[model samples]
Target chain A: MGKRVGLEVTVAVAEAVALCRIDMAGVYPITPQSHIAEHLSNLVADGKLDAEFVTVESEHSAMSAVIGAAAAGARVYTATSSQGLMLMHELLPIASAMRLPITMAIANRAVSGPLNILNDHSDIMPQRDAGWIAVFAENGQEAVDLSIAAFKIAEHKDVMLPVSVNIDGFQLTHMVEPVIMPSQEEVDAFLPPFVPHATLHPSRPVTMGAFSMSDYFTEIMKAKDEAIKNSKKVILEVWDDWGRQFGRNYKPVETYLAEDADILMLTMGSMGETAKIAIDELRGKGVKAGLIKLRLWRPFPFAELAAVLKNAAQLIVTDRAVSFGGPGGPVFSEIKSALFAQANRPAIYNYIIGLGGRDVAVSDFVGMFETVRADKAKAKADTYEFWGVRE
Target chain B: MNIVENFDLFAPRLINKKELFSCGHRACSGCAEVLSVRLMCKALGDNTVVASATGCMEIVSSMFPTTAWRIPWIHVAFENAAAVASGVEAGLKALRKKGKIDDRYIKVVGMAGDGGTMDIGIQALSGAMERGHDMIYVCFDNEAYMNTGIQRSSGTPMGASTTTAPAGKASSGQKTWKKNMPEIMVAHEIPYVATVCPSYPLDFIRKFEKARSIEGPSYIHCFSVCPTGWRSPSETAVSMGRLAVETGVFPLFEVENGHYRMSADMPKKLKPLRSYFKPQGRFRHLTDAEIDAIQERVTAEFNKLTQKAKFL
Candidate 1:
C-alpha cells in the first residue's frame, strides 16, 4: 500500500512522474501548469528524479524536444496549459503520427482573447483531432493515477501513441487532496522499462517523420485512425490491471444512480464530482436524475456511453467550451453524432457552463436538472444555452 | 584534429571512403546544398543522429520507401531542428546513464535551411545553443525559401531579387541586409561557430570534424548555391560558392571560444562583387549604383570581421 498524503494535485502528479522513472522531461511553464513543471525540475535538481529536465524556450519546443527524445528511445514527459497548449498544437499530431510514446499533462484552462487563465476545457477542445489518447481526471487521486497510467498506455507496444492527461486548471490542480502516492515498486510492476518499437540509432538507421505527398497521405491518415481506434482494448486492459492492483477500479464512463433513470446529467473533468452531489440532491426530491462522468475523451467510449444512456429519457449535457458558429458545444455536437443512429436516443440539452472559471456550484447543476424536467415537453435538442450568462 | 591535418584538397584517397549520405538522392543536378550535406555526413561518420528540418534536404533525401540517409535521421518540422537535436543529445545521455543503451558516444547533428534557421527556427536554435547542448547545428544558407519557392528570407542578401522581394519599377530587390547568423550564434557564447562552403570541400570537412570534436554546442552556416532559385546555370553551382567566398560575400571563418580565426589562404584583396553577381539572374536587375552600394556594405562587413580576427 502506498502512503496517503495531502498534497497539491500538481505536486502529486510530479511525484507520480518521479515514481514512473521517466528518462527525460522537456517542459515550459504556463499559468496553472507552472507548478507541475517547477516541481518536476526541482525533482531533477534535488536528485530525486534521475531525468533530464530540459527547460525549453516555448511549448512548441517542449513538444518538439519530447518528440525527439521519445524517438531516441527515451521515456519522456511534458506539461503545459492554455496558450501553451495552443503553442504545442502544431507538433501534437506530428508526435502521434510518428508513433512516439510521449506523455504530457495538460492543465486545462481557458485560452486567451479575453486573456483569462482559469479552469475551462477551451485548451483541449481544439486538440481533438491531434490523434492523441486523452483522458480527464476529476480529482487529485485520479490526476496522479491517470498521469502514471498515461506512460504505460503510451509506451505499450500495441499502442505506441502519445497521451495527454487533462486536469482542470486551478480548480483541481491547485487544490490539495489526500492522494495515495503509489510506491516505485508498484509503478515499476505496472510499467516495465520502455522498449521502443523503433529508435533513432546509428546501428539501425530508420527515417522518421517523412513527408507524405498526395501519393500516400490518405493511407497514412487511415493507419493513424485505426491505431487510435484499436488502442481502446489496451486502455481497458491497463485500467483493469490498475484496478486489480490499486483497489480503485476505473472505467471509461462512470455512472452514479444511472441504472433505470429517466433523466441523466453528463459532465467531464472536476465538474463530475459536483454533478454527483447534484444527482444525490435530485434523487432526494424523487426525480430519477442520474449522472454520467466521461473519463476518456479520445478513442471515446462510444459503446459504454450508449449502454449507460440507453434508458434515459432526457440528458443535460454540460460543456465548458463552446464551438463558435457551428454546433452548440464541441462535446454536445460529438455526443449528438454518436447517438444520432440509436433507436431510443435521449433528448439531449447542452448547457455551456463555467466560462473562464465561473464557479458551477451544486445548486447550478440542480437548477439544470429542474429546468430540463420542466421543459421536457418542448425540449429543443438542437440548441444550447449558456447557464450563467448575465445577458 | 590530426585528421584535418592529413586532409589534402587534391587527393581523393585521403577522404573517408564511407558515404553516410548515399547517392541517388532527388536533389537537383548540381545542388551544392546536398553536396554540403554529403560532406558533412562523411565528416561526422556513422556515429551520429541527424535531426533535419522540413526543407529541400529532408524532402529529397527522405521520400517514403526510399531514404538516402545511412545515418539515423529525423525530420520533425521546419523550425525545431535545434530543439529536437537538444532532445536527442539529452535522450542519449539519459539512456547511456541508465544502462538502457550502450555507453558509446554518439554525436547529435541538426540540419536546416536558411528559412528554417534564421527565420522561423531562430528561437529554437538560440535556446539550444544557450542551454549548451553537445550538438552541431548546420544551417544550409541558400538565402531564400527554395523548397517552397524563391521567396525572400532573412538570409537573402541585399540587391538579390527573390519571388517575394522581386526587383521592379518600385522596389530594389531585398530591402534589408542579410542577417548575420554566424555572429548571432557567437553571441550565445557557444563553444564553436563556423562558416563553410562546399566549394572548399577540405575546409568544410575539416570544420565539420572539428565541430564534432567539440564538447558543447557548435553552429555552422554553410553557403549552399541554389542554381534554380538564383536563376544561374546548374554547372555554376560550385563556382557560385567559390565566388561567394572570393568576393567576401560569405567568408570562410571559425570562432572558437570567442576567438575568431579566418580560414587560411583567404584572398588578401577580394574580387569585385560584380564578378560574383554577374552570373546569377537574380541580381541582373540591379542597377550599377545598386551593385556599388551592395559592394560597399559587403566590404565594410568583411573589414569588420577581419578586424575582429586581428584583435584575436
Candidate 2:
C-alpha cells in the first residue's frame, strides 16, 4: 500500500502548528470545524503546545477569549461553523475595529433560513463588511497554507485586522487527506513571534476601547478603512514571503485558461474545483472558456478581477449565497461594482448554484452556459439567473 | 504609569474645561449617574474617550448631533460597550504601534445601565475581560430598567415595586433580591471591582480613579438614584443613596483580587432595615411581613459579606 496523506490532514496539522508557533489558543466546539479545536485542545493538554485552552461558555465566549488573549499579545486562534460564527457575529465587528490580529477558521455552511447546515458561503458572506480580512480556501492544502498566511497578513503593521480562514463545511472540513506538515523550526523561521503594538499590561497602563464623539467618530472609521485598504500590498507581500518559505504561492484571484477564451467562470471555496472541471471539459469541446478562483473575499480583489475580465466576452460568476431581494447574488453585485470604474469591463452574469450542499452537477454548468449563450443571443438580457432552482 | 501612581496620593487636579452635561438633557435634576459621569469626565479629562450603552447616561448625554460629551464619545448599541471598547482599544493600539497617532496614552471608559451590565452586556463584558483588555466598565444600577419604563432588572431589589414586578393581589412586586454583582465580578477574579455611589462624591471619584488605574477589566457598580423609577422626590436622591449603605441595603465596597473590603463598615448593631426600605414610594406598599423578610435577607447577606471579609 502506497502511504498517502490527504489535504485535509495538512490543513488541521498546519493550523495546529501555527497556533503552536504563534503561542496560545482558546476555543469552543462547533460543527464542520471541530477537529481543529479538538487537535488544539489535545496539543495543549498533552503538553505539546504551551498555551491556555479555555473551555469557554459559548461561541460568544470563545471569540471573547480570543480577543482577550489576542489583546494580551498572544497569537490567539479559534474555529467554528456557521451558527457559531453567527453567535459571534456581534463581536466580529468589535474584534475587527479593535484591530485584533486574531486568526479564526470558519467552516462555511448555509445559515438556518429554513433549517440548513450544509456547505455554502452564506455564513461568511454576511460578515463581509464587518471589517475582517476574509479568505476562502478551495482545498485542504490551501486551507492549511492560507491559515498560516492569514496570521502574517493580519498581524502586519499596516493591517491589524482580524482574519477569518473559511473552508467549505463538511466538504473540506470533514474530508480526510494526507498533508505535508511543516516542521516547527521552519515555521518559527517563517512566522516571527507576534508582538502586539498595544496591549493590556499591569506595568505600562493605557486606556483602550473608549468613547468617540461626533468630532472624531468619522475619523476613527476613516482610519480603519484606510488601514484595511492599505493592507492589500501587505497581504501580497506576505503571500510572496510564504511562497518563498513553503514553496506554495497564493493569489487573491487565481486564473486558469483565460488567455483566448470568450467566456470565464469565476467562483470561490471548494466548488471552484467543480467549476474548473466544467471549464476544462468545455475547453476540450472547443468552447473558448476560462476559470477564476477567488481566494480573498474581503479586501476584495476588485482591481485584479477587473484586469482579468478585461478581454472576456461574457463572465459566469458563481455565488454560493443569496442577497435575498438584491438583483443578483451578493458576490454578483460586488463583482459588478468592482468593474464599474473600469472602462474596458466585459459583461458580467451572476449565477447562484450549489446552495445548501445541493449537488452542483455537470448539468448545472451546462445550465450556466445556456444562460450565458442566451444573453449572447439577446444583447439586452438581464445580468443574472439562479441556477438549479426555479424563479 | 507614574502619573497613575501619583494621582492616588493627591486628589487629581481637575483641568478647567466646559461642562459636558448639557442643561436641557433628560436626566433627573439630582441623578447620580450624570453626576458620576461629570466626575469621571473631570478625572479622565479631555484626552479620554467614553462609550456608553442605551441607558440613562447615554440617553441624557447623546442625541445624534447634540451631545453632552465634549471629548470623543461613542454609543454603538446596548450590550456591546465592552466589545466596542475592545475594538477602540485595538484601534488605538494599532494606531500607536504604527506610529500613526501620538503616544499620549488615552483612557477608554465604558458605562452602561444595570440592565445592560448585569444581563445582556455580560457576554461582551466577559469577552473584554477574557481578552484582558485594559478598560473600565461602570454599571449605573438604578436597580431596574428605568429607561424603558420601570421594569424589573436582575439588579432590582426584592419586594420593590417595578412595572414588571407589580405589588398587587398575591404578588409583593420584585420577588427576588438584587443580584450581588460586585461579588459576581469578584468571581471573574478581575484585578479590580468596586461599588460606589454619588452621595459619597469623594468615594465615587476614588473608585473611578482606582478602576481606571487597574490594567485589566475593572468593574465599578455605581448606585444611581433614579427619581423617576424610585417614585421619590428628585432632591432626596443623594440622601436615599446614603441611607442605602447606612441601612446596609447597598454596602459600598471594593474587591481586588478577591480581597473584599467595605467602603464604610457600619455599626454591628445597625439601624432597622425598615428605615431604608419604608421611605421609597415603590416600597410604600410592602407589608410588615414582606418588609421583615427583606430585612432578614439583607441582614443575612450583609453578615455573610462581613464573615467572608473577617476570615479572609
Candidate 3:
C-alpha cells in the first residue's frame, strides 16, 4: 500500500473497473462520481478496458442507460450522487424488479431542500425499496475493494439484483488513499466474463417485466424476495473469495470489542471511524461498550444484527438521514423490524446524527450514551433522538 | 352473446394457460378498454409484458397483490409506466444477449389512461420514443381521468363537462380541444403510429398486429370510451365510442413511416355531431354558437384527415 503512493483516486476507481472487468459503464456528471466516469471513459476511449462507456444526460438516463446495457448482456456500472441519485429514484426499483446484475457507485450527499450539497447518507435512505444491494464504504480503499466485490456478488447467477457501492461525498470519493491497484491481468484471472442468464438478444427474445395478473403477482414478487433472501449466501461466498484474493475482511457487520461488551453502537458509512473512537474511549473509561459497523444494508444482515444485539443490554443506531413523519431515521425502523420477532430483544434507540453535513463528534456519542441511560431511568424512554439539531 | 365455433379466435398463437392480460376484471358493461385490451393481447400474444399505469382499468384489474395479467407484468408507480417499460425492454434485451432469455417474444408495452398518456406521462413517453426501444405504447383515451373522478384531461374533447371543466357560466364545458397525441407521437418519427377504436375489433387487432410486428418504437392512441367517466349509462360505452368515429369527433386511422391511412373510410351519409353529444350530460350545456363552433371544428379536422389518408 505504501509503495503505491502519488496515485490519484480517479486512477484507483479505474483500477476498480479493471478488477471488476465492467462491461458497460453508463454514467452522468455529478460531483465525485464524475471522476470515476471520466477515468473509465478515458480507459474505454484508449481501448484499455475494452468496455462500453455511455455518457448520458441525467442520472435518470444514466440508470436507464445501464438498464439497457445490463439487459443487453453487459455487466453494467454507473456512478451518481445527491440530485443525480434522486433523479434516478424512480428507475431504481425497476432495475431490481427486472433483476439486472447492475452495479453502481453512489457518492453520497444530502438531498437538496435549502439547496445545500455535501457529504451524507441522506441521499440514499429514502430509496431503501429500490431493490439494490446497498453497501457503505469508510474510505477510498474500501470503495475500490467493494466495487470489485460488488460486480462478483451482483453478477452471481443466484442474485441478479443491482448493487451500490456507497462512499461519502467528497470525503472518500476525492480523498487520496493507498488503494491496492490490481493489474488487469490479475483481475481477468480473478473475475470471469459476465454471462447473463437472461439477455435481450434478438436471436432468442423472452418477455421480462410482463403484465402479471392476480395469479402470478405474488409469485413475481416472491421470485425477487427469494432472490434477495438467498443472496445472503452468495454475498458471504463473494466476500470470502474477495478477501482471500485481496487480503481484507469486509463482513456484513464487523464487531469491535463486542465479545464481552455491552451498550453497543451500530453505525455505517464513514461514521464508523467516529463510532470506533467512541468505543475505544468508553472502554478506556471502564465502560463495557463496543461498536458494530454495518457494511451491508440491503439483504439487511438480519441474522448477524440479531446475534450481535441480542446479548447486549442496550443497542444504539446512528443514522445520517432524517426520515420525517416516521419513527426517526430509516435505520431505526429497519432495526426494530429485524428484531421484532426476536425473543426479548434489548432496549434499542434510533438517533438521527450528522445530517446535512453536520459533524457527528466523539462528544456527541458520549452524550448519546448518557442520554440513553438518563432517558431509560426517567421512564421517558423514546426509541430515538437527533444528535446535532436543536429541539 | 352466444359462443360460436369457427370464430377464428387467435387463441392458438397464445401459449396454453398463458394470457398476458388476464380477464375477470370489473370493467363496466361494454367498456371499450376491455375490448382494446383483448385485441392488444391477441396481437402481442404471450411474448410481451405490459406496464399498466394507474387508471380505471388498472384499479379494476390490478389491486395490490392481485393482478389481471398472466404474463410477466409490473405496475411501478403511476406516471412511470413508460419509463419502467423502457427499463424492462432494455433489461430483457441485455439478458437475452447474456444467454439468460429466449427470443424476441419479450416485447414491452405500456398501457395508460389519457391523463397518464397525454399529460403526466408525456415526458417519459417522449423519452422512450426518443430512445427508440422496440416497444408498443397504447394510450387508452377515455376523455377524462375516470379512476380519480370525472376530471378533464388533455384528451377530454371540447364541450365535454368534467368535474373541473364543468358546464357553467364561466365555461361551456371543456373549452379547449383534445390534444392530438397521435400527431405528437408521429412527430417522434417512430417506426409505427396508429389510432384505433375498440368498436371495430378486427381493425383494432390488425392495427395492433402491425404495430407489434414492427421492430422499433410504435404508439397506438386507442379510443377507449368510458361510460362512467362520460356521464353515460354503462351499456353505451361501446356504441358511444363508435358514434364518436361516425360523427368525425374521433377518427380511426393509422400512420406508418410518415404515411397516413384512415382505417375506416367515412361514409357519405354521416350522422351529425349532435347525435354523438346529445345523449351525454357532458355536452348538454352547448349553446347554439358553441354547437356551431364544435360542428365546424369537427368538419374541418375530418376533412383534413380524409385529405391526408386519400393522398396516401
The candidates' DockQ values read 0.85, 0.11, 0.13
TM-score of chain A of 1: 0.99
Docking class of 2: incorrect
Which regions of candidate 1 are displaced past 4 Å?
A: B1-9
lDDT of each: 0.93, 0.75, 0.77
lDDT tens per residue, model 3, A59-145: 776776577667657777888899899988987888898888888889888889866677788888878877789988887677777
What would the TM-scores of all predictions be? 0.98, 0.75, 0.76
Q: iRMS for model 2?
A: 8.2
CA deviation > 4 Å runs, candidate 2: A1-4, A7-20, A341-344, B1-113, B122-140, B145-152, B158-239, B251-264, B268-274, B277-312
| Winner by TM-score | 1
- A1-391 per-residue lDDT for model 2 (tens digits): 1123654542474444544464556566777677777777777677666655555656776776577556546677778878889888977887887788989889888988787878898889888889998888888777877887788888888899999988898888888866556666666776766767876532343333444567878887888888888888998999999888878899999888987778888889888887778878887888887888899888888888877888888888888889988888888888887787888666777878888888897767866866686676546434666676865
Give me candidate 1's TM-score against the actual structure. Answer: 0.98
What TM-score is obtained for chain B in each of the predicted models? Answer: 0.97, 0.91, 0.91
Judge candidate 2 at residue A354 and give its lDDT.
83
Clashes of each: 0, 15, 35
